[model samples]
Target: MERLLAPVKAFLHGETPSSWIEEARRPERLAVVLQDHLLCELKAAQTAVWLLRRYALDKGGSERLKGWLRPFEDRVYRPCLVKEHQAMASEVTPAGLSCRPDAPLAGPLVEKMVRLIKEELHHFEQVRTLMLARGIVIEPIRASRYAASLMQLVRSGDPWVLVDRLIIGAYIEARSCERFAALAPHMDEEVQRFYVSLLRSEARHYQDYLALAQMASPEPIDARVREIGEAEWRLIAEPDALFRFHSGVPSAL
Candidate 1:
C-alpha cells in the first residue's frame, strides 16, 4: 500500500481535508457519498470510453464500447430501472476494441483504458451492492463542481487537448486514490475494506493517465502539470457548498 500511495501522494497537489472526512463519515452522509461515488465510477468509465472514441478506437470499436456502457448509463439516468440494470452488471465485456491504424499510441491507450473501464464498472457494481445491502436506494444527486471545473482547463486542439485531458485524468484518479486512503480508517469495517481494496487500481489509473499524457505531449509537461495541479489544489483546499466524494472542504463541516 505504501508503494502504491507514495507516488499518488506526490502526484496530487493537496490531501483531502480532515474536515471533509469528518463530515463524510457521518451516518447521514453515507448515502450521499455512496450515491455520488456510484455515479463517479460510471463517469470514470464514461471518460475512458470518450478517450477511446476520440483518440484510440475505430467506429466499430466505439459502438461496441457504447453498447457495453448503455446499461450502466441507464442505471444512473433512469433510476426506476435500477433492478433491471443490476442484472446486467456482469455483461460489460467490450470485445473487439479495434483502434485506428494511424492513431499514435493507440495500442497502449486501448489496452490501459480497456482495463480501466472494466475495473471502474466492477467498482460501480460493488458500491451499488453495498448500497442495496444497506437498503439505500439509488437516487439522483447533483454532481460536484470538482470534475467539470478541472475540465474547463482543457485546451481546444489535438495534442494539446488530449494532453490536457490526460493530465486532468491523472489528477482525478490521484485524488480518488488519496481520498480512499484517507477515508478508509474512518469508515465501517465493510466500507473500509472496500475503500482500501480500491487503492491499488486507483493508484495505477493515475499513473497510467500521467504516462499517457506525457507520451501524447510533444514536449515536457512539467509546466502544464504544475498549472493543472494548482487548479486541482484550489478545488480541494477551498470551501465547497456541497459534500461529495471529490468535493472540496465542506463549509458546514
Candidate 2:
C-alpha cells in the first residue's frame, strides 16, 4: 500500500486534514461519505469522457462513449428506477471508441482515459453495491468547492487549458488516494478492505493524469503542477461546512 502511495504522497502538497478523517470516521457519517464517493466516481468517469470527446474522439466515437455511460448516468439522473440502476451498474464495460487520426496525443489520451473511465465506473458500482447492502439511501447532497475551485485555476486556450485541467485531475486523484489510505484504518473491516483495494488504481489514475498533462504541454508542467497543487492544498486546509469525500476540514469538527 505504501509503495502504491509513494508517488501520490510526493505529488500532493498536503495530506487530508486529520480533522476531516476524524469526522468521516463517525458512524453517522458513513452513508453520506459513501454517497459522495459514489457521486465522485461518476464525476471522475464523466470528466474522463469529456476529455476524450474534446481532444481525442471523433463525433461518432463521442456518441458511442455516451451510450456506454447511459445506464450509469440513468442511475443518478433518473432515480425513479433505483433498483434497476443498481443492477445495471456491474454490467458496464469499455466501449472501445476510436480516437481522431490527426490529434497528436489522441492515442495515449484515449487509451488512458478509457481505462480510467472504466475503472471509475466500476468503483461507482462497488460503492453503490456497498451502500445497498448497508441499506444506505442515496440522498441528494451538495458538492464541495474543491474541484470547482481547482478548475478555476485552469488557464485559457487550447493545449494549455487541457494541460491545466489534466494537472488538476492529478491532484484530485492523488488526494483521493491519500484520503483512502488515511481513512482505511478507521473504517470497518469491509470498508477498510475496499478503501485499501482502491489505492493502486487511484494512484495510477494520478500518474496517468500527470503523464497526459506532460504530453499535452509544449513545455514542462512542473511550475503549473506546483501552482495548482498549492491551490489544492489551501482548499483542503480551509474549514468547510459541507462534509464530503473531497471537502476541506469540517467546520463542525
- Against the true structure, what is each candidate's TM-score? 0.95, 0.94
Cα lDDT tens digits, model 1, 64-156, are 889778778777787666555344545655466788988997887888888898899899889988999999878768999999999999999
Model 2, position 43: C-alpha lDDT score: 92
Model 2's TM-score against the true structure: 0.94
Top-scoring candidate (lDDT): 1
> Candidate 1 lDDT (Cα, whole model)?
0.89
Q: Which stretches of candidate 2 lie over 4 Å from their true place?
A: 81-96
lDDT of 2 by residue, 126-181 (tens): 99789989999875578889999998898999898899999999999999999999
Q: What is residue 130's positional error in candidate 2, in angstroms?
A: 0.5
**Residue pair clashes in candidate 2:** none
